[model samples]
Target: MRKVDLLDELRSEIGVVSDKCADQVNDLYQFVCESLQKKMPGYQWVSIYLVQDYAFVLRHDEGERILPQSIPFGEGLISVAAARGSMVRERLSGRVEVYMPFYRGHHLIGVLVVIAKRANVIDEEDVSLFMELASLFETKVEKYNS
Candidate 1:
């Protein structure tokens, strides 16, 4: 398969984002994570975490290893995006990680994290596009939850 660009892949699925009901949102998370892992070059894993009780709970993931059930909502590799409400690009060990937050209006609800198997597979531009996509998804979420 041809290497896919993150922005292009997300744009191609513009119409695929469906209802943001509780159950449907979970399916959407799984779908988005699976799609990213399959199509995005160097993206070895993808996960979406929802926050509750001041922590992040891994709701969906597409990868080999299972992550912890929950993590404290603060400074950390996975919590950076949700903590800051912005995209964070960091190089840990040798892998590049991009963390994007899912916010509804001003309240943060979750985080989308893409882990790259290779160094520098994703960059600032990719993060920007991902943020926009997250915003679109957030709109649906906010509409339903409010």
Candidate 2:
């Protein structure tokens, strides 16, 4: 939204972060989700789903509503996004859910789900920003996991 100008700042916020946890990748995911929700008020919920064992496993989430901890490979919007390797924007009754898939090389890493309380909240610029965020998340995850 209007926070587009905060791109560099947001990037820097997530780029140089390192958490001392057993599961650092998930910790980074949680940090990114929190940062997104705090910086973008339009995002009522933010969650990271890692592709593990052919399923979308919920690594971390920061939001008002609780979500499923896991989704089967071919069950829902996450599956659709993963299949296409692109962002899937869905407008529901009261919210707009954007499922953005990111990768490490040709391998799909995970999906970043951002939910806004109002419909039509995601636009072209937002999509671009989300892609950048997903790339940053992928880089951080790769570095941490390796």
Candidate 3:
């Protein structure tokens, strides 16, 4: 499917989930993680990490490999993205990691990390879509937290 189509589908689904489960932000995250992982080919891992006090706690994820449950501030790429309040994209030999930060108003709140097995799997368009997705996630977060 096209990237815009995928995002539209996700946004619609997230709207439904938001209407039904407005207080359960984790469920919304889970739906997004699953939908993106299944619909978007080449995505090896899709995860959302929410800020909890001093660290980022894993909220929802869908993938084959295991990942850390939490990451502290100023530690890893995820934290770097959050601290910088911007998206971070890293391309390695075989994989590409995109970390898109989410915020509550002006304060950083979380990060959405997408990992693809190959560097070519993600491009500029994909990053833009992910940024929108992250914004949607942030909106839901604020909706539920308010």
Candidate 4:
């Protein structure tokens, strides 16, 4: 399916699911990881890292051991996004590293990391969709935590 179609399906799924908070978040995270991995063939790993106080905790992941369970705010991709509060997409020889921030109002909630097997695979459209999905995840998590 196309990216738009995939996103639509995910949004529909999100709409129908019961509000179980943690379960929903996990489902959403998995959905995003799977969808990106499938749609972007170059993407080898997709993960969400949530910020808790001074740390970025790995909430979920797809693909190989591309991320640690947790890292400091200024250590890796997670910290790059957290510190800048913006999306960072980098192209390496055979991998593409992307970091999208999850923010609610002015507070930064977390970061989503996408690792592609090839460089420059993450485009503008992908970044846009990732941001939107991350926002949705952040909103739900914030509500659940409140």
Candidate 5:
């Protein structure tokens, strides 16, 4: 399938999955991982890092395993997103880091990071889709925390 079609499918599936998993935390993470694997085939890693006490804690992840699931604000992609309250896409030779901020009103809640094998692969469409997905995840997290 074309990249655009694949992205659309991912976005639609993410929305459906988010709605279906709204009441459950594990389900939401599973859906996100599945969607990322389907949408960005070259992504080597994907994770959701939540903001807690002004820091980012890795709440969920897929692809390569990572330990120490927490990082201070301004340490990595999650921190960058949380600090800026915007999407940050960076490409470095063989790797790509895409950070999407999750916000409820003006408060930044978390970030979603997609690490791909090929640099410069993330596009505008991907950013838009990621933002939508991040918002869904944010809502779920907020509801779960409350």
Candidate 6:
């Protein structure tokens, strides 16, 4: 499928997420991880890591999980996105991971990490869509947490 089609499919999936689920952020993360992994087989790993006490703590992950509980403040791709306050995509050989920083208002709170085996799994447009999804996730959090 084309990138737009894939993204639209994801958008449709997430669009139906009841606003009530926002209170359970970990559950919300799991739901999204399962949804994306099932819909897009190329997606090898889907996870969310929150910035806790100056460290990137692994909050949730789905499928073939092997990441540590916490990583150094400025290590790995997730850290790069957090430090730069923007999205960062890394490509190596035939695998790729796109890290997008998730914000709680103006304050950066966490990072959304999407991994795929295919070399061309994502592009600029997809990054934009993913950012939209991240914003949606944050909105849900804000509504639920308030």
TM-score of each: 0.83, 0.83, 0.87, 0.79, 0.83, 0.86
Off by over 4 Å in 6: 1-3
Task: Report the C-alpha lDDT of model 2 over 1-146, residue by residue, as the tens digit.
Answer: 34567766777777766434334667677788898888877889899898889789988888885458989899888899999989999888788899999888789989999899888666777788789878877776677667
Q: On lDDT, who's better, 4 or 6?
A: 6
- Tell me the TM-score of model 3: 0.87
The CA lDDT at 19 in model 4 is 52
lDDT of 6 by residue, 97-139 (tens): 8888888787777888888878787667667877887888778
Candidate 4 achieves a global lDDT of: 0.75
RMSD of 3: 2.0
Best model per TM-score: 3
Query: Tens digits of per-residue lDDT for model 1 on 35-119?
Result: 7777776787888888888888888888754357788877477676776778888888798878788787888888888888877
Q: Which clashing pairs does model 6 show?
A: none
Q: Could you give the C-alpha RMSD of every candidate to the true structure, in order shown?
A: 2.7, 2.8, 2.0, 2.8, 2.4, 2.0
CA lDDT scores, all candidates in order: 0.74, 0.81, 0.83, 0.75, 0.76, 0.78
Give the CA lDDT, 0 to 100, for residue 48 in model 2: 87
The stretch of ten residues in a row with the least summed lDDT in candidate 3 is: 13-22
lDDT assessment of candidate 6: 0.78
Between candidates 1 and 4, the one scoring higher on lDDT is 4
The regions of model 3 sitting more than 4 angstroms off are 1-4
Rank by lDDT, descending? Answer: 3, 2, 6, 5, 4, 1
- In model 2, what are the clashing residue pairs, if there are any? none
Error of 3 at 15 (Å): 3.7
Superior candidate under TM-score, 2 versus 3: 3
Show where candidate 4 strays beyond 4 Å: 1-23
